[model samples]
Target: MSNITTAPFTYESLSQLTMKEGVLELQVGPAHAGSGHMRILVWVEGDTVVKVDPDIGFVHRGVEKLSEDRLYVKAIPIVERPNLVDTVNANLGYIIALEKLLGLEAPPRAQYIRVITAEISRIISHLYGIAIYGIFMGSSTVFMWALADREPFIDIMEELTGARLTYSHIIPGGVRWDLPKDFGERLEVALKYLEGRVSDYEKIWMNNPVVRARAEGVGILSGAKATELGVVGPNLRASGVKCDVRKCAPYSVYSDFDFDVPTFKEGDSYARLLIRVEEIKQSISILRQALKNIPEGKIIYEDYYKRMTPLMKSIYDEKGRVKFTSLLTSLSPPKGQSFSRVEGGRGEIFFYLISDGTKNPYRFRVVTPSFRNLPYFTHVMPGHKLADVPVIYGSIDYFPPEADRR
Candidate 1:
């Protein structure tokens, strides 16, 4: 037998190969079809995606670093910028951390309000994810319906918080506003509409044969692997992992509300899609419960309330609103480090704060679910077809801005 030496694998050797029979590279861009600015380098071999390398970090704003420069309360809106769709939960986690540092707990009504807004934010985020997922899977109807349904929720949010997307409503002491007088009525109507629309979604998208063929068994991430990779949110739950920050560690008023933490055993793209639907239903249930059970009390804690000026207190009493004071611009919590976690629409989000008894936090760190779940991309993309890239992407719901924050 003749001695034959194998050629070394290198960039030059790969470049020399023909594009037709050999692997071809396709760049999905800075203006990628989905939400954030992210590039995906796909290496294809005969319509099969043999390897996928997710190129991110184009939207990094150094949110964590910036938080150190701003006062504790001012950082809320700064952190909110990274994940505009999931605003309430993102703000909630950081506020909870600040509250821990100051040894403050929001009142019962404030807790309920936080729960309602956070859950609403969760629904909004999930709808956005599902809409993108539907479009990626080649179903325009699904996208249209999801977006159309999403508008009512956004309207409700605007009425409640005065801003549609980036509402820094949750503060260290309590929420910024109380439930609007007609908020429950409007919410009930929207919930009714959503209840009907979810069934329509099941018929038009989830149960559709074409969608099933494309999404089912595609991009499977097993529980063991998901755990090993430290994935969170619906992605981890879809992988048969029963982990949700809401259920595992009850924060805000989530422990009081009765709602199921939806999970799936399939751990595939279809499962991820279905889990969002279930989560929406559960969120609606929580919303209804929160509306019914919300107590009539001060939105802010007495400690914060007492310190407000007469005019500010009057505004809060009359309109259920408050303004940021000069004191808030220079908060000095006792020297200590505290961390808080919340179950966002995507998954578990964490905020760690270090206070040296100063106006600004000495150190601030965030662990968003998208950042934690990113590894799922490279882990599951290898054995899938090139056509399945968008499906896998939409299912994971990776938000690059949130993930890339320093």
Candidate 2:
């Protein structure tokens, strides 16, 4: 065999090359929505993308480092701050790791409540992502309807957690509060409204000729490729992968509920979009089951309960909620390392924590779905038309803050 050599394609060489032969370079974004202020460099040969480089980290805030500085309980707020729409899901991973280190599990009633809140957050996050997807695809009506539908869920969250977003509701021992007396009825009404609206969404967005032509078969990711790339959540399921943290690992009370993991063989932007819609329906089903079979019992672990003052205990008894004091800041679990995984709106989220029997953790690490899904863009974007970039990116619902937190 003859020896062969290839030179690296550096920016300096590209700049030095002639601007002929239909080779063009362009920049897309600083995207305005979904992930804010993120850019992608596109190299085009005629109208087709020859290569694309994603530019991220516009909103990095060192979330993992911040976690190491804060106390164990106080870090809940810091953990979910990156992904506000999926607060309960984002917090669940960290809380699970914490509980593992502490060797405690939330009560059965608490587990059910956690499921209820987490599924609601999943619905909210999917709505927000789908709305953004609609806007990116130039369907303002879809954006308007999906966002308007989201308010009811947010209203319910406010009632449950006393916050519209960044709830910090999921704690190590259990959730923060018991369900309200009227929550079941309100949720049923909301789910019904959403179920009806989903059909409208199908008619106006999914089945629309323009949307179907633009999204269907565009940015196809084969099942083998999706698995090889380690894509997660709806993006992975859209490619016909039968994997879900809830179904496979069954953390929390996910095993108690029965809901299908939606999959599509098309593995395109359209399939990704529809998977999320089906997941929303599944989440509604889960919520109905959880609400119907929810048990009545303690919301927090007995160990934590015994440490509460009489006045605080009285408040908990009256309000069905616990008020944590700064005294928890001194908590130091036994020396150990633990990891947790949860299904977020976009995909799977993972947390790895190391404790050294100190006021602060020795290490805190996170792998968000958005972060894991990012590689798929580099792998799939080439050979598609330049216009297809945003469609594929939006379909993935890449949240930069969550991705860049590390």
Candidate 3:
């Protein structure tokens, strides 16, 4: 190790670091500065930012460590609590990795359930993004509107899964329950309602002059830069690229669905916002199709669902709560590593699972969308006014702090 000397710093140290040297100091809440409220220190020599040291740990929850003591099955719900906006994506990613590790796969019907829930999750996630974007831009009307619109999707998930947000539905081999009575009918109606609501989102925020001004040509990340930064989902697509994990690397029953991946070339905050709005509509289309063609095969894998006792079956049929097969109590995956990435509402979410064929996982790692996208705050902050920080931050849809596996 090399010992080097660095200058003394402050909590709100967003001052002229060195006037003679032209070195500016950017105080990061969690990126730079002291860890009071998570600030970032942006030091500029002349026109470029030199260092972006993060001062985080403001809201550090031991999610990964908590999973280590918990059985593999128990970790599913706990791992998803940090990023509530995209719970389905988190649950699916973790379970898929576990399934791969254990050499198990959900049946065809179970896969369909995964797709429906995942797409619905996509809608809710985007709704949160747009609302956050709206509030940041001083447009509470759109925020209120988006939040209200999201309620129906949440309610649908509740009816189908017996819980609204923390849907610990997707387990190792398959989902927890079958759809409730008239499940398909409710889904179809919800999809239709969402289809109409999506258009309204566009009219209200996507292309509105004020929102566009705050976003257009702002924080423009080129296609190459986006890829280099390891961004994914609509964020990558906004840079004029046609890359979506669902279509390019189809998971679960996604390959069977017909949907378009919305992309734009502008590569700015505005473009990212518009791309997500378009993506929401595509999700509605998929939801409609999923319910329209839901088959009557055993809702869960026969190897699993067939064994459910009458008591368990009653709980499932009436409330759509899945009764787990006993095997989940101690999911001892093989002593190997598995990594899986899925398109989350914020961007691409990754899961790294290591098992020793024991009741608990040996090691687990996760990468959230906001954590990966934090670099945007540095690149876009300097050129704009001080007040525009939150607006741009909102436009980028920065999320709550999540766990870092290390």
Best by TM-score: 2
Off by over 4 Å in 3: 1-37, 42-54, 306-321, 403-406
Superposed Cα deviation of residue 287, candidate 1 (Å) = 0.8
Candidate 2 lDDT over residue span 327-383, tens digit each? 455778999999999998888999999999997989999999998998666778777
Residue lDDT tens for model 3, 201-297: 7777676877776666666777887777666667779887787777777778888889998889878778888887888888888888887777766
**Cand. 1 TM to true fold:** 0.94
Can you list the residue pairs that collide in candidate 1?
A: 233-347
Model 1 gets an lDDT of: 0.86
* Model 2: ten consecutive residues of lowest lDDT: 1-10
* Pairwise TM-score winner, candidates 1 and 2: 2
**How far in Å is the alpha carbon of 116 misplaced in model 3?**
0.6
- Deviation in angstroms for 292 in model 3? 1.9
